[model samples]
Target chain A: MQQLDNTFTALSDVTRRAIVARLADGEQSLSKLAEPFEMSQTAVSKHVRVLSDAGLVIVEKRGRIRHCKLDAAPMKEAIDWLKYYEAFWADKFASLTKHLAKD
Target chain B: MQQLDNTFTALSDVTRRAIVARLADGEQSLSKLAEPFEMSQTAVSKHVRVLSDAGLVIVEKRGRIRHCKLDAAPMKEAIDWLKYYEAFWADKFASLTKHLAKD
Candidate 1:
């Protein structure tokens, strides 16, 4: 549950979500990651750091270059949490429909 | 995307997520919703305000009671976004496995 909080917090920023979206294609450098955004590399790197801290993305140092990759284990946790409620609500609604049908 | 940001941010807090989980069970008032937490009712209301602002939960007023319901439209959007990346990453891994199999 705490893990879900961190995951959701890290993903709260649009730029961070965009970074995750891009990395879903493949890993890339800080510059490449910042290419689509109007922000500086430093700004983007800060976002990546937040993601790294949350365990959403892993950063590797390849010589002097920083590489970012999607580390989706935390995301899987968030998704699992959300899915529980999704199924819960679905079941609730289904039961309601059944009850209505009888009336 | 802003909606996604708000949704994620709202869901980021453990207390708020807990509130959401409770609401998934059924609609309840501000006090009823605050029953399970160690925090004060004011604290819970503040968290619920954030969730209500995010559009993830709907707050209704009847007489003196404030009712909270899970408004899942935004959660659906967030899930849809995550599902896209989930599919993308799955495809990427599948292609990698295929390539490795050829070797």
Candidate 2:
């Protein structure tokens, strides 16, 4: 439960989502990850910290560089939770479509 | 982006998620929705408000009662965002499986 809370909270920002999207291709040094964002490295680091804390990202330090990697396990958990309601919503949509067709 | 942020933030709490789960069955009175939780109606109301603000729920007034209905469009939007990474993660898992098989 707490992990879900953390996962959702960590992903609640656009910058963090973009960071996650970038890291999906491959691991990146912290500086490289910060390059596309308009914010300072400090700001990007803060966003990365949230993702790391949620276990959605893995950060490793090699020499002076911090490498960020996408860890999709927590995200899988989040997807699993959402999938529970997938059928529910699908049914709702189906019924709404049927209702609309009649009107 | 803001809607995604709001949806994720709204679902960050267990109570809010539980409320969402309940609403999945059908529309529910705010008081009835608060029944299972140990917290006061006000606390549950705040959670519902967050869900409502995120467009994940629809609250309708019927006389003096507030009926909460799950508006799963926002959740669907969230799932769509998360689905963008589904293939990426699946590839990772496949690689992991292949590596483990080699070991």
Candidate 3:
């Protein structure tokens, strides 16, 4: 779906990839996610928004804190699509080896 | 690799995805690849060049024909990376279901 596209597109950014990697450890507040990077909090917020929109992250407000947790559904879909293509390449590579051997 | 990044970024475009899908069938000359699309041959050429640089396609010149064939090496890497993330999600989802059942 369009959400899947947005998720993949957002994940394509290096900054967003790091955010997802951080969230993989455990849920963290918005400030904590932004702390390690030199980027401004506003920039980190935008990256988090992209991940949340992609369903890669779940954001919830508890008291005054915005906690982010990895959702993982969209990541699974992206991975499924990638795995299919990976199998295709494995076949292609095997054939390539055979073709080269025949030469 | 930077080339891999460029290839994935280029392929993120719908036009380039169409071009790669077309090249998957068999080797085709530059003009043949451009003919079906309403886009200019120059635009198609740019897409083809991006694919060629990504190592997704092999280009060889025989007479005036520039034939492009799917290379599949970089595609293998991208798919492999995606597969790893997909497995992570599967585990996360399984855990989520268990927690939900406990509720």
Candidate 4:
């Protein structure tokens, strides 16, 4: 559950989500990952740091360059949590339908 | 995207997540929702407020009682966003399999 806390907290920002989306294709140098955004590399790096801290992204330093890669396991956990409520919603829908049928 | 931000931020706390989980069974009075936790009703109400701001939970007043209900739409949206990366992880797994095969 703490993992979910970290995962969701790290993902609450738009820029962080975009960074994750970009890294989904393949591993990228921090600079390369920062290129698509208008923000400074430092700004982007901060976002990456949040993602890394949450275990959503992995950062490896190779010489002077830092590379970022997506780690989707935490994301899978988040999805599992959200999916649990699917049954709840499905039941609500079923009940709604039944109630309407009575009318 | 802002909705996603609110949804994720609202869910980042353990107490809030527990509140959400309990509400999944059915609508619960605010006091009833706080009953299982050691926290005061005020503390639980704050958590509920955050969930309400995120549009994850709906609060209604019937007389002096507040009925809290789970709104699964935002949770569904969050799941949709996370599920987009399913393809990325699947591809990564396939590539890992191929690499292992070669070794």
Candidate 5:
């Protein structure tokens, strides 16, 4: 899907990937997630924005704090695309196995 | 791995993704791979080059023909990286299930 391109592009950035990693562990406030990185909160928010735009991260506001979490559903598309090759390789390997057995 | 970003980046293009999808069916010569698309063989070659650069596709030249194939090895890193979020969601869902059972 076209959206998968956006998803992959969003994840291409190391900072965005790091944000996803942090969110994967648990829901975190923007401030807390921004703490480990040297960048300003605005810069971190931009990374989060990109991830959110790509549907890889979901952000929610609870009272005064906004928390972010990883949404892995779109990630399935990326993995599914990759997994097709897995099946291809498996099929190739099976044929190879059969060929070897014939020898 | 930094290369994982390139792997994802390469697959972001629709033409490249189509090339990968085609390759997944079986190994194909460059000319054969280019047949379905309206683009020239040179354009197809460029897409293949991007895929090769990302290590997602492998090309072998035998005789006068070059065979192209899908390489799923590097894909494992991308999937493995995503599976970490799978664990996260599994953990979250498990806790929710436990809480529901208690109610």
Candidate 6:
């Protein structure tokens, strides 16, 4: 749990979101994952660590390579919780549009 | 927005999540929302404020009573981001099930 909390909190940063987006393409080595960004590899590693803690990503070691792959379970839980509120917003936006049309 | 970051960070707490869950039922007054939890009204208010800052909740003051309503928009954004990974998880789970069945 606390790890889960930190995971989402860590991801609240746009940099982390961008890293996750890149990882979504396929598994990549830690160094490869760090390449596109200006941040230090250590910082990217920290972000990856947070993602791993959240269970959003799985990291595996083989020979000299450490590969990171996206893990979906925690993300599913997060999305489900978020979806409840998405419905609320959809309804509110619909009502607003309807009122605007009437006006 | 730093406010958005803080809002999600604030919501990572279970107590705040529970409060959001309660508010999802319908709009409720500040004290009424605070009553179910043993925490102080001030703490609950702080949670509500975070929710408001996150655009997850709308607070309106009518006389001395402040009503809180679920806002839903920021939640939609959060869910959309989470959903991308939800799909990633679904695919991974499907593959895992297939592999397990083969085994």
Top DockQ hit: 4
> RMSDs, each prediction?
4.5, 4.3, 4.4, 4.2, 4.8, 5.0
Evaluation by TM-score, superior candidate among 2 and 3 = 2
All candidates' lDDT scores?
A: 0.81, 0.86, 0.71, 0.86, 0.81, 0.75
lDDT string, candidate 1, B1-103, tens digits: 7889999999999889888877766778999999989999999999999999998889999999999988766787888777776653356776466447434
* lDDT of model 2 at position A97: 70
Q: Model 6, residue B34: displacement in angstroms?
A: 1.7
Clashing pairs in 3: none
List where candidate 6 sits over 4 angstroms from the true fold: A1-7, A92-94, A97-103, B1-7, B92-103
Please report the TM-score between candidate 4 and the true structure.
0.86
Better of 3 and 4 by lDDT: 4
User: Pairs clashing in candidate 4?
Assistant: none
Task: State the TM-score, rounded to 2 decimals, of chain A in model 3.
Answer: 0.83
| Candidate 6, A1-103: lDDT as tens digits | 5654665676687777777777767778999999988989999999888888777788999999999987667766666667666666577667587347433
Better of 3 and 4 by TM-score: 4
- Model 5, B1-103: lDDT tens digits are 6798888788778889898877766689999999999989999999999899988889999999999987867777777787776654456676466447433
Q: Local error of candidate 3 at B24, Å?
A: 1.9
Best by TM-score: 2
Q: Candidate 1, A29: how far from true, in Å? A: 0.9
Order the candidates by DockQ, highest first. 4, 2, 6, 5, 1, 3
Clashing pairs in 6: none
**Candidate with better TM-score, 2 vs 6:** 2
Full candidate order by TM-score, most accurate first: 2, 4, 1, 6, 5, 3
Writing each residue's lDDT as its tens digit, candidate 2 over A1-103 gives 9999999999898999999888866789999999989999999999999999999999999999999988877878898899888875678667487447433
Stretches of model 3 off by over 4 angstroms after superposition = A1-4, A92-103, B1-4, B91-103
**Candidate 6 deviation (Cα RMSD):** 5.0
Give per-residue CA lDDT, model 6, range B1-103, as digits (tens). Answer: 4654665676688777887888879899999999988889999999888877776777889999999876666665566666656655678676455445544
